[model samples]
Target: MVKLDNVDRGILHELQLDARNRTAQEIADKVDVSASTVRNRIAELEGDGVIEGYHPKIDYEKADLPLQIMFVCTAPPTERSEMVDQILDIRGVVDVRETLTGRRNLYVEAVGTSTTDTVRISDSMHAMGLSIESSEILRQRQVQPFNHFFFTDPYADGDDNGED
Candidate 1:
């Protein structure tokens, strides 16, 4: 495990907030460090695989592919990990998750333009020998950065004396 100092945590928090638009200098300002330090720390984090990759928060509905479905299935405990790559290969499959539990151990999320697309995904999974327990249409998903790395607003302070 990589040891992260307060500055590293601060940098990670700021980056999680808006990695694409927030520059190193902006993170440095919030972390009370120099831009160079922020950049170097980010490099170290990436090399250590702590920061895997940046992903956009896409709105599939706005993109005109509104059908988002989650498939909960049960696979042989020993085969779940091996199935990840194959399941991902299925068109429209966006995410696959393996759980420690025995029943309903495999979860797959997929996007589609129509009901036929969803049916095709189900047929593919069935062909792969997966028992689909349930398929639900996902309404929404929300995400937030880990709160352990949370920081107070840079402009907010202990001295809260009637200020907007």
Candidate 2:
């Protein structure tokens, strides 16, 4: 694990705000660092695994897959990895989150054109010997940005002085 300093946090903040099409030089200007420095820091972050790959935020409404279904699956501990791989192969399944402290060990999310397809994905998982529960996602409300201030606040000290 690598520790990130204030500058590193600032760089990450700028990238998250516009990483889809921002250049390192652009991020550098915002973070008050040289362009090469920004680029190198980003490289270091990626190398250290702090920064994962970047991806686009798709508008599922216009992408033909409007129905979102979330699922919870409980399966044999030994078969967990295989179960996730099989679930990923299902047509409507989009993403999966593995868990550590819950009754269910797997959380799966899928998007489809209709509820029937989503249900079919769940049924298929059942046939694979995994117990599954699923729900329809009516809407995706929000994805809030990271609190860059929490990491970059200069006045912050070991003790809380005034601001809350």
Candidate 3:
């Protein structure tokens, strides 16, 4: 595991808020370090795979992709891989996760311009011999980093609480 000093943690916290606005010099100023030090630390973090590539959070509505849906799919044991592959081929699919549920073990997140497009993608999944047990539109107002929030000291060796 990568070891993050306080400065590194501060840099990450700042970047998470506004990835595009800060430069190494600015980050150094905030963390009270040299610009080169900040740059080197960031590079080291990136090299260690602790810091992934930066990304722009695009507003889907502005991008003409407003509708969002989640699909819970179930497939025959033998056709699971094929069904997953077919679902990934759908145009609007953004994410797919293999869940642990008997009725529907696959969760798919997709975005499209309209409900019709979302339905078309669902229909295509049906045509691929995949059974969609349940589907729903996801209205996400706020998203938070639950893992980070809950597990602040991820490397702690002892039991998190005495309750366990």
Candidate 4:
């Protein structure tokens, strides 16, 4: 684990808000540091493996795969590795998470053109001998960058309606 000072955390907060658009100078402006300092810190962070990589924030609905299905399963310990690899290789599989605490050890998400494809993916997992406890998804609600809200609230530029 990294032990970051207040300034380091502040720089990270700014970067988290918008890594693509924010330049080092802009981030330095927000965090009260020189641009060179921000640049150096970021380089160090990347070297230390703290800042791994950047990714485009994708909207699944806008993409062709509007239907999302998550399968929560419990597979034998022996089969976990192979099951994960197979899941990753499967078409339409977007993400797979292994959990420490739950009736299900793995949560696998797959995007489908329709509900039938989602079921087919789950059934294939069953064929691999995984015990699927549940398969469900609703396209109604989602929150983006929700996990980092607390870390970067100081730099957020969004309008708040708390007064109203």
Candidate 5:
């Protein structure tokens, strides 16, 4: 496993907040490091697979495709990984998550312009032999960076970092 120091955690925290607009220099300033160091660290993180690709948060409704459906499905444990890969090739599918256990082990999210589009996506999943247990319309989703990534200096605030 990759061990992350405070500076590394700080870099990740700042990037998670806003990677699109935050430059290496800005992150370096937050982490109290040089700009070149931040750049090199980011590169190393990417190379080590610690930092995955940056994805933009899209507003599908604003784009005129308002329907976002979440499909809870089941697949054989052995086939789960392959099914996820194939499901990603389906049009309108935005996300897929695999759970560790239970009957509904696969969760797939798809966007569409209307019911017809969503139905088509459902049919495709069935063709792949996925037994869909439930499907729901997604209302909203909120995401934030992990709080532990934000290093709070105990001495800076004279609070012992919330220790008991």
Candidate 6:
């Protein structure tokens, strides 16, 4: 694993908040280092794949993609690859997950310019031999990183339900 010092961690934290705002000079000022040092550290982080490429967080409403759909699907064992390929071909699909649930084994998150686009994607999935268990338009009230839930323990040992 790549080891990060406190400075590196702080750099990452600040970048995560607003990747586009701070320059190497500003980051260096915040971290009390030379600008060249900050640039080199960022380069090192990128080279090590710690810092992936940056992206602009686009507002879907302003972008004309107001509809967001989550598709829950099940693929036949023989058609799994075909189903996945079809889903990847869809224009607006942002993310897809192979879920543990046997019935709705795949989950897809897609954004579209209209409800027609969402329905078209869903229909295409069904035509590709994937069973569409259910689909719903997602009205995102708030978005949180999945790592927040997965990395932290939300309950104590005493709160166990004794499933194991």
Q: Scored by CA lDDT, what does every candidate get?
A: 0.87, 0.76, 0.74, 0.76, 0.87, 0.73
Candidate 1 lDDT, tens digit per residue, 47-144? Answer: 99999999999899999989999999998888888988999999999999999999899999999999999999999999988999999999998988
Give candidate 4's total backbone clashes.
Answer: 0
Write down the RMSD of candidate 4 (Cα, Å).
Answer: 4.2
Candidate number of the best lDDT = 1
Q: Which 10 residues in a row give candidate 1 its minimum summed lDDT?
A: 155-164
For all predicted structures, in order, the TM-scores are 0.90, 0.81, 0.68, 0.78, 0.90, 0.71
Q: List runs of model 6 lying over 4 Å from the truth.
A: 75-86, 98-105, 144-164
For every model shown, the clashing-pair count is 0, 0, 0, 0, 0, 0
Query: What is candidate 2's lDDT per residue for 59-124, written digit by digit as tens?
Result: 777899888778888877777877788888999787888876445888888888986887698789
What's the lDDT of the predicted structure labeled candidate 4? 0.76
Cα error, candidate 4, residue 119 (Å): 3.1
lDDT of 4 at 20: 89
Q: What are the per-residue Cα lDDT tens digits for candidate 6 across 57-151?
A: 76776788898888988987565655676688888987787865567788888889887897788888877777888888888736433222113
lDDT of 2: 0.76
Q: lDDT at 10 for candidate 6?
A: 52
| Candidate number with greatest TM-score | 5
For residue 60, give model 3's deviation from the true position in Å: 1.6
Candidate 4 structure quality by residue, lDDT tens digits, 10-95: 67766766788989988888767899999999998888888888877677788877888888899877667667888887788878
User: Which candidate do you rate higher for TM-score, 2 or 3?
Assistant: 2
Model 3 per-residue lDDT tens digits across residues 1-164 = 97777777767765665658878887777667898998898888889998888876656777888887899888776667666777888999977887656568788888998878988999988888778888888776365332242236432445432111
